[model samples]
Structure formats: structure tokens, C-alpha cells
Target: MLHIRVITPASRTDEVLRIAADSPAVVNVLKLPGAAFDPEGDLVEFDVAREGANAVLADLKALGLKDTGGISVEQLDLSISTAAEAAEHAAPGDPEDAVVWEELSARTAAEARMTWSYFAFLALAVQIAAIGALLDQPILIVGAMVLGPDFGPVAAMCFGVLQRNVRLIGAAARTLAAGFAVAIAITLACAAVSRLIGWIEPTMLDDRPLTSFIIHPDRWSFVVAVLAGVAGILSMTARKSSALVGVFISVTTVPAAGNIAVAIALAHWNEVGASLVQLGVNLAGMIVAGIATLFIQRLMWSRLGRHDIAPHSPEVAAGQPTSGRVSG
Candidate 1:
């Protein structure tokens, strides 16, 4: 379930109410007249099953409420009402499979921002991974994999492609490119320092049995990357975050970057080239698979025959209807 809070202008309150009334998936509706001080409008709040959120939100957007007032949505962790249960049952699809595009866009947009924290995490993850590669420690490699936050921009890039949002696509692409550059530079610097201190010798990177895969790209690597991309996209849309960690662990992106840093510091030029190839393979595979997954989801949602609401539709949601009630 999702909770929606809308601030609607006085003139459009009825239309807003009508959208709620027409949907069996909306429950526990509340209307507060003149309740919004900043926007100077009425406040309408309701809970809707996830399956109906996209349709309802699209309808609300068509009404131009976003320009005149505001709309906000949040996930409902627990709703004990019988009305909530009925609403969920009335919805056409399962809650777990629902995808609220607006919410997703907002999330990915924020993720695409190249913030200080993003660089910090990426740099630290790469540094840890570089050390792991030098020591041939599979455990540290896995730890760095879990710690990396590269999936955010990757998912954003995939979503941007799906929606054909050129601005979003550019922003996400830049973020990915700049993020890796920063992480690699930092990790390389760290490895160079370790080499100066005589802590790591060039031969330490030669027979890295546990971590050699990080620098080797094969068909299996691409296959695993594609599968990981699909699973990562699914886990996110389904809101199963725990599963996303497994997605992170299954990919070699961070590890490849780590291997590249160590190889450069140790002057193993051939290994550096191979590690670069491995990184490219993983990224290419993920982007291709992620774009396909999102396209499939959009197609499936469209097949349900509930998309944009027509601006000229006659159904004006006048006042409260029997479908919903205002709390006194």
C-alpha cells in the first residue's frame, strides 16, 4: 500500500475527490478544506493499494495539481484497517509487483546526483578492493563488493533509457563516468603509496589465485553480469533491498576497478588492460540487461490498459462519494 498526500486548489478539489471515489483501491480518504497554508488549498490524504498508485498518480498529474499545489507518496509499512484489506483485494495486481514510475524517477534522479558521500563510498570501496586484490583475499573483495554503491547510477541510467529522458540519461552517465574516475584515481594513489612503503611488491599481483578473476574477462563474466543486472532491477522495483546485496556481490565491476588500480601501481601493464576489459564487459552487460528489464516492465504495465488519464474526461470527482468518506 501507498499513502498519498495531495494539496489541491479550491477549484479542483471536486475533481480530486472524484478520482478517489472512482477507484475501489483507494481507502481512508480525508479531505481538509483550506488546510494548506503555504499553498492556500485543501488537503486530501488517502491510502491506495500499490497496484493502483500509478494510475491514480497519473490522473492527479493530468489535473495539473502538481503545478498548482503538490502531491507526495510514501510506502505504507503497516495498515490494519479492513478497508485497506478490501482496497488491496480490489486492486488488479499484486502489491509486490507494482512499479510507481514517479517514485522511481525521483529516487533515481537523486541517486544520479554526484554528491560527496557518493565519491567517499566509491573511493573507499575501491581502495579496500585494491588491497584485497593485492593480498589475493577473496573475503575483502566480497566485502568491497557489498560496500560499493555503483548500482544507484547504473539503475538511474537504465531508467533514463527506458523513459527516453535525455537529461536524466546524461546526468546518470556522467555520474557513472566521474564516479569511477574518482574511485580509480583514489585507489591508484593508495596502491602507489603502498608500493613506495615496500608493503606490496609487483609480483604480489602475478599469481593472485583468489582474485585473478577480477582481471580476466570471459563469456561467463558477461553472462553473470547480465543476470545480476536483471536481478538487481527486479529486486529494486519489487522493493526487496536484501536481494540487491546479492546482486552487488554477484558482479565484478568494483573488483575489476580494484584490480586495475593494483596492476597500474605494480606496473603490470597487461593485467591492467585485462582488468579494464573486465570492467567494460560487466558495465556493458548490466546496462543492456537493465534497459531490457525496464522495457519489459513498462510493456507489462501498459498491457493492463491503465495509463495516462485524459484531460478532457468528463468524470469530475465532485465532493465525497460513497466510495470514500471524509474523516470528521
Candidate 2:
């Protein structure tokens, strides 16, 4: 279930009430007239089944409430009302399978921001990966993979393509390119310092099977990248974050970049080239696979009638019948 809060202008209060009345999935409706001081409007709140939330939100958006006032939705973890239960039962489709595009877009937008903290995490993860590669420690490599934040922009790129938002796509691309570039450069500097201290030597990087795995690109690397991409997209769409952690550990993007940094410090140009190939291959595979997975999932949902509750035309929603009380 989801809790919806809307601030409606005095002129549109009737329309808001009518829309709420028409939505069978909404329950526990409340209205407070002239309750918004800043917006100078009435406040309307209700609970709706998760399966029907997207439709309600879309309708609210079409009403221009989000611009004139505000519309906010919060997940309801616990709702014990009989009305809530009835609303959930009346709403069609499985809540778990529902893809709230607005929510997903908002989440990805936040994730795609290239803040200082983002670079810090990415650079720190790469540094850890560099040490792991030098010592042939699989555990530290896996740890770095978990700490990396590359999936945010990657997922945003896929979302931007689906929504045809060029700005979002560009922003996500910039965040990714800049984040990785800085991380790699910083790791390279760290590698130089480590080499000076004798902590990272050419001998540690040569003929070590584990380190070789980080530098070498093969068919299996692409395969794993594709698999990780699928899992990552699914986890995001389904809001299953635990599965996303597994996806992170399954890909070699960070470790390969770390290997490149170390190889450059050690003057292993051949290893550097191979590691670059590995990084490029995994990134390409993941993005392509993520785009494909999201497309298919959206198509499947649309075909299943799960996506049929988009906002009605303005005229249509305006003509919708009202069935509930509107105080004030």
C-alpha cells in the first residue's frame, strides 16, 4: 500500500475529490481545507493499493497538482484497516510486479548524481581493488566490487533510454565517465605511491592466476556481465536490494580498472591493454543487457494489462463521476 498526500488549489478541490472517489483502490481519505499555508490550498490525504498507485499518481500529475501544489507518495509498511484490505483486493495485478516508473525515475535520478561522496566511494573501492589485485586476494576484490557505485548511472542510462529523456541520459553518462575517470586516475596515483614503497612490485603481478583473471578478458567475462546486468535491473525494478549486492559481486568492472592502474604503475603495457579490454567488455555488456532487460519487462507488464491504468485524458478525468464525500 502507499500513502498519498496532495495539496489542491481551491479551484481544483472538487476535481481532486472526484478523482479520489472514482479510484476504488483508495481508502481512508481525509481532507483539510485551507490547510496548506505556503501553497495556500487544501490538503488531501489517502491510502491506495500499490497496484493502483501509479494510475492515481499519473492522474494527479495530469491535474497539474504537482506544479500548482504538491503530490507525495510514501510506502505503507503496515495498514490494518479493513478498507485498506478491500482496496488491495480490488486493485488488479500483483504489487510486487508493479513498476512505478515515477518512483524508479526519482530513485535513479538521485543515484546518478555525481557528488563528492560518489567519487570518494568509487575511488576508495578502486584503491581496495588495486591492493587486492597486487596481492592476488580474491576477498578484497569482492569487497571492492560490493563497495563500487557504478550501477547507479548504468541503471539510469537504461531508464533514460526507455523514457526518452535525453537530459537524463546525458547526465548519467557524464556522471559515469567522470566518476570512473577520476577513480582510475586516483588509483593510478596510489599505485605509484605503493610502487615507491615496494608494496606493489612487478613480481606480485606476474604469473599469479588470480591477478591474471582480473587483467584477462574472455567470453566468460561478457557472459557474467550480462547475467549481472539482468539481475541488477530486475533487482532495481522489483526493489529487491539484496539481490543487487549479489549482482555487484558478480561483475569484474572495478577489479579490471584496478588492474589497469596497477599494471600502468608497473610498466606492464600488455596487461594494461588486456585489463582495459576487460573493463570495456564488461561495461558494454552490462549496459546493453540492462537496456534489453528493462525493455522486455516493460513490454511484458503492458501486455498483461498491469500498465493500463495510466492517467485519463484531462477531459475524461474531469467527467469522471464522484462517489465519496468531500469535506470543506
Query: TM-score of every model?
Result: 0.93, 0.91
Residue-wise C-alpha lDDT for candidate 2, range 182-265, written one tens digit per residue? 999999998899889977688878777766788768999999999999999989978899999999998898998888888899
lDDT of 1 by residue, 204-312 (tens): 9878788888877999999999999999999988999999999989999898888888889989999889989998999989999999998888778656654522112
- Give the poorly placed runs of model 2, Cα more than 4 Å off: 307-328
Best lDDT among the predictions, by candidate number: 1
Q: Which ten residues in a row have the lowest lDDT in candidate 1?
A: 319-328
Q: What's the true lDDT of residue 217 in model 2?
A: 86
- lDDT of all predictions: 0.85, 0.82
**Candidate 1: where are CA atoms >4 Å away?**
308-328
